[model samples]
Target: MNRPPSNILGKGWLYCTVFLTGAAVMVIELLGTRLIAPFYGASLYVWTSLISVTLIALALGYYWGGVWADRARSGLSLIIAIAGLLTIIIPWLTGPVLLATDPLGLRLGSFVSTLILFSPSLIMLGMVGPFAVKLSTATLAKVGASTGSIYAVSTVGSVIGTLFLGFYLFPVVGSREIFIGLGIALLLLAIIVAYIEHRHLKSAATTIPTALLVVIGIGLYPQIANSNRAESNESFQTRFERESLYGWVRVIDKPKENIRLLTVDASTIGAASISHGENLLAYQKIVTLLPALAPEMKRALLIGQGAGHMAMTLKDYGIVTDTLEIDPAVAEASIKFFGFVPTGKTIIGDARYEIRQLKGPYDLIILDVFTGGSEPTHLLTVEALAQLRDLLTNQGILALNFVSFLDNGQNATLASVAKTLAQVFPHQQVFIADPDTDFNDFIFLATNHAMNLNDESFPDSHRTWLKQRLVNIDQSQGMTLTDNLSALERLQIRKSEHYRRMIIDLVGTNHFIR
Candidate 1:
């Protein structure tokens, strides 16, 4: 027996419902990353909190949906009601999550707070799929098709939501308003669907309650999110850029004074502009340290590429240099802020991937990609190192960064990183890049040539400068990130609840790691 045409439309509507629900759930979840990132940072813990919260809510939604679906008796009414409820409550819920990120420190744990603040909304959003599908298919024969249809639709919605939010909404209003506005949009969609399915004016009566909630939600948006680049004058020109939940980036230049600054979130890194002869800003001190280990700079690769300080040094020596920067914005900034005019090739991709793609016979490869106490673990892994080493010249040099201690004390991650590099570099030399701040600074110089800190390896020129900056002290303990170790090497430290906790403490609570 053939089913009536009404069944097909029912299936289509059900699919649409499932997909839109999924789309909404994902959009908010992705958006959530930005909310807590400003407070706690975009670190592993933030990821931990984000993933855990989403999964837990999803599980609850699935269980509750299964039980609640049967009680509805009328699939269409339940679907409309759920869709409507999503729209109204989300806007009302957006403000509280943002407000809860205060006392920004590890102690406050923005990740945990955000989880609690946003979970209910997410849990409700999560309930859309199973609930939508269950109602559309009461029998086993239709269940698979119904479920798949819903999933597919939701995925499509996810694509639309992600693109819309990432490119258009978040950039203009930032995550704060994006969260509330998206919530309003989702709520309105639900109300519209409810009105369509239930023509009774009473069925559409959710408008008043939803409207009241959205009014308050709109009031909660934070005023300052993304204007740093636009507002700051050309004097503080931005050279490089990267946009992530972590923060917006700007490599500011003050050429007349000879200084460049790399600002991300609220923190910054900078040095003197060579064009202005203002004296190298604090960052270029790395080059002063590196040459002590190996004098050769025939051809090199520099990671991080900020305002092209290291590259500038290399170019001055007539050394050809290639740069690996993950953000296109940084390259664009290079032109505007640093007057860095990139010569030769610059790859806008992860260092790990770019290194593997290299057809190089490089004499030196310097790593400068650090934002506070973190860098991509993969970029430091054995495989990444091996691929990088393959690109090195016969007597080439490899300079890796390891934070010693800053403002506070010894950084365990940096100590560990030093230890790991020691395992690979063996006789490698470690140097201080930014000397003015005595907290601690390091450059892991790996070379086959025998070099010592006292003589040619630690040149008199750089050493004298380091002494002047007051950063000559040594750090006894730190984290190990070496080429010889397996990728799983950091697993114990990475898995430790304490390690993450310690970082929360070291980087400051409000300073999130993503």
Candidate 2:
């Protein structure tokens, strides 16, 4: 069994190792979501998989660490060194692991991919806490205090790491860079611990080469990943890519099809034609037609400024529009690539919070929010609908863009949304963008008064299509989602899974998964 450190400096170094390892654990857990988001999406299932895998890995590590601490002569250096190596190799392992697990479907695929990619490093990091507790304990009497102090320090590290990554690092740093930097830090930490313990550079002979490998990996891996991304695929070409807190924001252009798409995670937010810079999405067209529903529509509020298509569309009709978009990266991409100029005041925040902040009596309030293959449950609740209702004028129209099946077989989530909306605006009319399929972009136009459309200005095709696909939603078909209780995430798992698969099928997986 190992003896406790003899000096204060030695003990301090040991505790530092514990702190860094604790931080690394939380960082890896959060970064795992970003890594998988491009391919599998940051869906509810993906989060569940990563979270569940992290807990399991930690549990196993805790048990193994306690046993090892009692039996082994060294402290946490070797475990940390091994973990660092595994962490460094994650970017390399990610592509292969995702490819192999792709056939497992979203839930199982994401769970298995996370297990394969993160479990080993997490298990090693988990060993740090128990080992630190063991190494710091001096006597049987003081063991309790030592354990408590060490754990408290570790928890503090975790808290700091969570805040740092979420608030700062996520927007600026790439996932691979963050992973490599973390791995290198851990490696250097292992060396420090070894030097403190042995009082010579000789003890770190094994770890020195491993650290060098991590350095080389950091340099070479990016080139390899970039080369793969730059592969000559005739189907599509990636024009822009940025990893943000919201999702993996990408602008993919299909020259053959003459389309440019703005995709976040697994969902395409907007698409524009290459030759003409016009928005090519059916939902955007339907939304543009919304102003015709209210001829005196002077002011509008657009939630989810996706590529700023609908916002720009409203601006074209001489309406003063305010936009609420969460991701700054998305806003940047929309303007730089899609030629979207913000016509009015643009607020960069979540819809729920920003909606509360707005002092609006808007004639048109559009709800076109979607993230990670599903609508945010918090924004779709009855309480959220009430907020939107309060913001609208008496004759104002609230047009919601939703993706779900119109048929009874797979329409539970859709029905729930319809039910929630009806609670606030009872007079609602639903229209399908594509009548050929059950799963289509369903636009719900809600108003306090009876719905009437002035088709005089609209083209013959637009007028005919609008009249043909008008659908009546059965509001009592599902449960009401509210702030107190929400099963929207649970109810949307299957729908999200289907949506993910459809995206993969439409655009080949290499652009995302690789």
Counting clashing residue pairs in each candidate, in order, gives: 38, 0
Candidate 2 lands at a TM-score of 0.92
Q: lDDT per residue, candidate 1, 346-407, as tens digits?
A: 87888877777889988888887653433466677656666777888767788876543443
For all the candidates, what are their Cα RMSDs to the real structure? 6.4, 2.9
For candidate 2, write residues 1-514 as lDDT tens digits.
4334533344676667777888899999999988888888777788899999999999999999999989865646678878887887787788888889999987899999999999999999999888888777778898888889888888889998999998899778888778877877887787677666455222444455545644665565565445324356788888888878788888989999999999987898989998888888876678667766787999999888988988887887899889889988899999999998888789999898888889999999888884338558788888899999999999999998888777743377778878888888878888888888877788888889987554466667767778887877766677899999988878767667778788777777766753
In model 1, the runs with Cα more than 4 Å from the true position are 1-9, 64-104, 138-181, 200-247, 251-260, 266-283, 289-296, 406-412, 433-438, 453-459, 463-514
Candidate models: Cα lDDT each: 0.57, 0.81
- Please report the TM-score between candidate 1 and the true structure: 0.73
After TM-score superposition, what is the CA distance of residue 397 in candidate 1 from its true location, in Å? 1.7
